[model samples]
Target: MLSPMQLSKKIQGNDSSQRINYLYQISKKVVEKNPVLSAYYGNLAVSVAKKNVLKIHPDIKRQLCKKCRCMLIDKKSAKVKIKNKKKTKYIQVTCNTCKMTKYFPANKGNNHRLWLENPEAIVEIVN
Candidate 1:
């Protein structure tokens, strides 16, 4: 049987998205054991996407700390809170490792949704 790393390498061949996803998975798995290594892998994933001009998945992008390139796990590596200001409510995520904060608008009245979440965003489905 091929080792996990070798399998990942084989699966990632010629596909930047697959490679980024693999790196993100590796980073998430290694976060508890070695944070620095996790950050390194996360950075690698981001760099790969940038180099290939590919967009990272929204869910993966939101979970990564922009400044430190670390995976932000709620209540462990990050803090999550909701805040209201100027009639706008938003969810705030603060990365404990680098003290970085990100905000996402959460106005119920507006019914805001990411473009990817919309049904119309799907043009084709691959089997």
Candidate 2:
């Protein structure tokens, strides 16, 4: 029922998604071995997604440094620290490359209480 042009656009979107996934995988594999190469792949993936107006998967997005766009491997490319303030526990992940910091609130008795620890809640970012 769709026009040829519409079908072609759909195919192109699928191709873009596949390419992005491939790039993410490559970056993940090489991140520990060669950070520069991994970062190159990550940048390529981001550029391709941006060009196609596609969103990178949240799992992949979270593993990258927002400041340097570098692939982050724990204790290797990133340093993670937990801090408590006013009875609130939070985690700070600092990228070793750019020294940029990202903080996530922890165990706040909220709905988001450690998504990894909660098996019942679906791991989807809500808006």
Candidate 3:
């Protein structure tokens, strides 16, 4: 088995795909036990990807808090709210750990694309 330093070096030297995957796994595994550590790992992952000029996957990126870099799990680590103003709708995500809020447009056109609206887009992962 590799030592912690060697393991981290191996992860850092990997290609973008593998590195991001490792980061995601690490964040997910630690978020429940220690959110601060998870956030640190998440920030490290984002910085590494940015430094390498790689694209962080949208699915993974969306799950992380923009301000605290913490994993956002609704009712667990974050609070999610949907708001409507005038003719526009937006979803607000608040990071419970840091009290930071992020917003995302809920409608783009005639159709709404909120994750709950589409059945196919929702998948229950048994892991």
Candidate 4:
């Protein structure tokens, strides 16, 4: 069976809606059981899309952000916090144009401590 990454590339310039649907189905199953792998497939799709864009225009890459699909930037500050004290981690990504926040892993362990070590981008909580 071809992986979702492979399916992503094959469907890009083709008239194969059926094949694309198949890949999307596979992605749905993978998401329900294994989230990390789902992220990998998503990254692959983004990478393929990026490469296709670069192949066509070549200049759009200079103005786009890889992670957020927003305007390009030399640097970005990402913030992390635990919301509600129930170990629910949240990510606050401040791009030049958008200040976006999202909740992530429900049970982050020592990785949550990184929020403390890096204070420049990460906000520290005192509770």
Candidate 5:
């Protein structure tokens, strides 16, 4: 098996999306051992996407701390809590390293979903 660094180098020759994904995976794997290095990889992934004008998936984006560029693993690198304010329920994620907090709406009885998660959003399937 190729090491992460070697795998990353191999992926760098491929498409932007694939590179971003590999970088993020490396970041997640390294977070527990070295958060700074994890942040570096995470930042690199974001930069790659930006340089190519590509969009990162919502699920991946949400798992990253915007301010610190680190992976947010629940109860590990970050704390997750369900909060309610003004009758709106939301999930709150607090990054332990940088203390950055992010909120996501999770109100019950609401049928809203991200565009990508909706079935109508897919127009074609590629094999």
Candidate 6:
């Protein structure tokens, strides 16, 4: 299987510009008259790009999961714990199903804490 970085480059590579444009066009075409459809395509573009993001930037990769043609924020996004130990930051992911745990470096900046880690919040960040 391709590593996350490889997959990310493939998705965000210049070759994919056309596909991304197409998704935007489709999403725009249905936005007003068919909002649901617009959202469907928007979600698709985001989904496809998300995997690419994970590949290119594995630090935050686990937050998004593939769902159909769109990338959906895995419920597990909320399950991640960020910590600063010694001179490095770490991410801890808990498996809700099997109770297994995995760890990674918290490489990305902390912009997402407000969204994923915030309580009393019911929101999703697709794009």
C-alpha TM-scores of all predictions: 0.72, 0.65, 0.72, 0.29, 0.78, 0.31
> Model 5: per-residue lDDT, tens digit, 11-54?
67768887777777777778888888889988998999999999
lDDT of 1 by residue, 1-127 (tens): 3476675665466387877777777676677677787788889889999999998877778778889988877766778776888888887888877899988877586443332133332222221
**Candidate 5 at 69: error in angstroms?**
0.9
**Residue lDDT tens for model 4, 64-121:** 2335434222232233444554545553333343344444443355554443233332
Question: Which candidate, 1 or 3, would have the higher lDDT against the true structure?
Answer: 1
Q: Can you write out model 6's per-residue Cα lDDT over 67-117, one digit (the tens) per residue? A: 322212224212567777888888665543334455666656655444333
Off by over 4 Å in 2: 1-14, 86-88, 106-127
Candidate-wise lDDT, in order: 0.72, 0.66, 0.71, 0.38, 0.75, 0.44
What is the clash count for each candidate, in the order shown? 0, 0, 0, 0, 0, 2
Q: After superposition, how far is residue 54 of candidate 4 from its true place, in Å?
A: 8.8
Model 1 weakest 10-residue run by lDDT? 118-127
Selected candidate, larger TM-score, 4 vs 5: 5
The C-alpha stretches of model 4 lying farther than 4 A from their native spots are: 1-24, 54-127
Better of 2 and 5 by lDDT: 5
Per the 3 Å backbone cut-off, how many clashing residue pairs does candidate 4 have? 0
TM-score of 6: 0.31
Could you say which candidate leads in TM-score? 5
